[model samples]
Target: MRLVTYRATVEAEARLGVLVDGTVVDVARIGARAGVPLPSRMLDFIRLGPVAVTELGHLIEEAKGRWPVDGALPLPSVILLAPIPRPEKNVFGIGLNYIDHVAESSRALDTSPELPKQPVIFSKPPTTVIAPGDPIVHRADITQQLDWEVELGAIIGTRAQRVSREEALAYVFGYTTLIDMSARDCRRAGQWIYSKGQDSYCPMGPCIVTADEIPDPQTLDLWLTVNGVEKQRNNTSHMLFKVDELIADISQGITLDPGDIIATGTPEGVGAGRDPQEFLSPGDVIEAEVVGIGKLRHPIVAG
Candidate 1:
């Protein structure tokens, strides 16, 4: 079942709901009708594990029979937030996972840097997150070169430590699309923290598809377009290190908890790699899509 966090009106508080067809069925109201106490927040439900998801699935099935026919809850989509708006931890981003991205970045560097034997990881502050349709602040004064990276984001469901690649996927909750907005100038200084940690730099979600729905995470087609022009086009199959390996590698030292997001890097064709570097302008719209997950679109605005 597709779950969401939404609000009917701007003044109304956000509530967790289950997506049915094209409508959102509020879980609390449905749970009341089904005589079950549903958790108030998405994180709470996520912490409850598969049992909660299963129970919510059953509630949705029951609500379908009475929805619209009888007096059931029907919400408007104007104020819907992504499933998880503010994750507890900053997003874990892998750099140079795609060969073309590595090649392009290497060519631009003053000196060719050796590819890391392990995953090159960086953190994007949680404050950088913005939901689908939200405006992406361009921060023109701070960054002249604003680029977009289309990445497949994996959400961690269970607590994990030192997991094997074979069992890594079991710890995942689902998948979503992530637009890794980067400030090219800041990135060139040294570390990726400042370049990637700007507010609204990480725009993710439409919905998180449960891991079970996606049989093979490595074989999906992912791409991004800037104002209807395709800039990045590649498949997850090209990933140097697959999702399972990434999870296992990340969890080697740190303990990954529920709701932690790991963005499985982007392919090639970023604006920074262009001939004259075609960076994003204030009016540009970026659309990032993964085959089965969903699409994330946001307009660029001056910061």
Candidate 2:
């Protein structure tokens, strides 16, 4: 199921819906008219447990029984927000999780590219999140070296702590595309938070696909383009740390809840890893695409 959080009115609360046949049908709204009980918010709906998911599945199936868009709103007629526009906590991030990226960056900086013995971790504040069509702010005052890293974002459904790698995938709610917009120079100064956590730095969503739809999370294809030219392209199969390992390691003592987005790092082909760095500037458009998930686009603009 391609689930989303959207709002048609400026004063409306975010509502959960299923995007099907080019229309995002209000699950609860339609279900209510059909006399089915469905939660209106994605987080709240997820909190209802598996029964809720089953109900959501049933709702979509029922809606499709006749026609998916029969009573649904045309997707283009509404504003699509990030699946979770505002996360419950900071967005968890893994740095240097791809071997190819590590190699390229190390060589670019003239350092040995040794594989990390542990997952390199970081977090992005909630403010950094922007929806698919939103603008990615490029603040000129402190940065001229903004870059892009297309990553696979894993959304947690089951709360977990001390989860085993074998069972880590069971805790995932779904997947989405994550573009870790970064400040190359500030990050080079060793301040990851400032470099990666600025307002509208993280662009996520299109929709949160239910976990069942993605059989193997690490087997998806990841690619991103700047102004119609592909800049980064790779398969998730090359990730040094698989999704299960990442979750197990991070959840050793930390509890992951529904709507928690964990960016599983990115692959090689970033702007900073070139002889002459290529940073994003005003009017530049970037698109992050993940197979099985969808595309997330952001237009770079001056702040």
Candidate 3:
């Protein structure tokens, strides 16, 4: 099932929902009607663990393939927000985790082509997150080189610490499409927080496809396009640090809690890697997708 956070109207409260036949079924409402109460917030729902997800699955099945169930709204009529609209902490991002992307970055930056022995991790503050259809702010005064990266976002389901690669995946709740928007010129001291952590720098969602549906996250294909022109396209199989390794490695030191998101590094073809170099300008539209998850389409607006 594709889980999402949506609002019936701009003024309405955000509700947890599931997609069924092009409609958004309110998970909490459905559970309440069925006497199986669930949380309306995404983080709360995830904390309930697999049992809650299993129960929701049963509730969906109980719908019997019919959509627009009681309290359900057509997907188009609702405003879709990030699967986890406001994450509890900074989002962990892996840098240059794709082999080809590594080479491309080396060429663009005139650096070595050698890949990192360990994951190059970074963070983006919660303020950077925006939902699909929202504008990606282009702060022309601060950066003239606004780039784009389409990454697979892995949402943690349960607490994981010192786990092995073999057991890492069990802690993943779901996956979503994410855009790692960057301001090339904002890089300072090799730290990315300021360059990529500005307001509206991250655009995530459409919905989160529960981990059960995507048993093999590595097999999925993800891509990004700007104004209808394809910029990045590759499969998750090419990631230098797979989701399992990332989880296991990170958890070795830091405890990963439910709702913490790891944006698996992006593939090649970012704007900065281009021969002449390209950057987002106001009025540009970006559409990024992770197969089986969903597409995140947003516009670039002047800040």
Per TM-score, the best of the predicted structures is 3
**Candidate order by decreasing TM-score:** 3, 2, 1
lDDT of model 3 at position 132: 86
lDDT of each: 0.83, 0.86, 0.91
Candidate 3: 10-residue stretch with minimal lDDT: 62-71
lDDT of 2 by residue, 1-303 (tens): 898988877677778888888888887777786787787788887776667777777767766745434346788887889998889899999989899889987877543599998888889999999988999998899898899999999988889889999999999888988999888777655658988899999999989988889969978999999999999999999999999999999899688887788999999999989767788999999988998888988899889
lDDT of 1 by residue, 1-303 (tens): 667777767797777776777777777777877788887577777887777777877777766757633223454444657678898998999998888888888776432456557898999999998888999998867999889999999988899899999999999888888989998888655789899999999988887887778868998999899999999989999998899999999999988999999989998899888787789989999898998888888999987
User: What is every candidate's alpha-carbon RMSD to the true fold?
Assistant: 2.0, 1.9, 1.2
lDDT of 3: 0.91
Task: Look at candidate 3 and give me any clashing residue pairs.
Answer: none
Tell me how far the alpha carbon of residue 281 in candidate 1 is from the true structure, in angstroms, after superposition.
1.2
Candidate 2 — which residues are off by over 4 angstroms? 65-71, 109-112
True-structure RMSD for candidate 1: 2.0
Of the pair 1 and 3, which is ahead by TM-score?
3
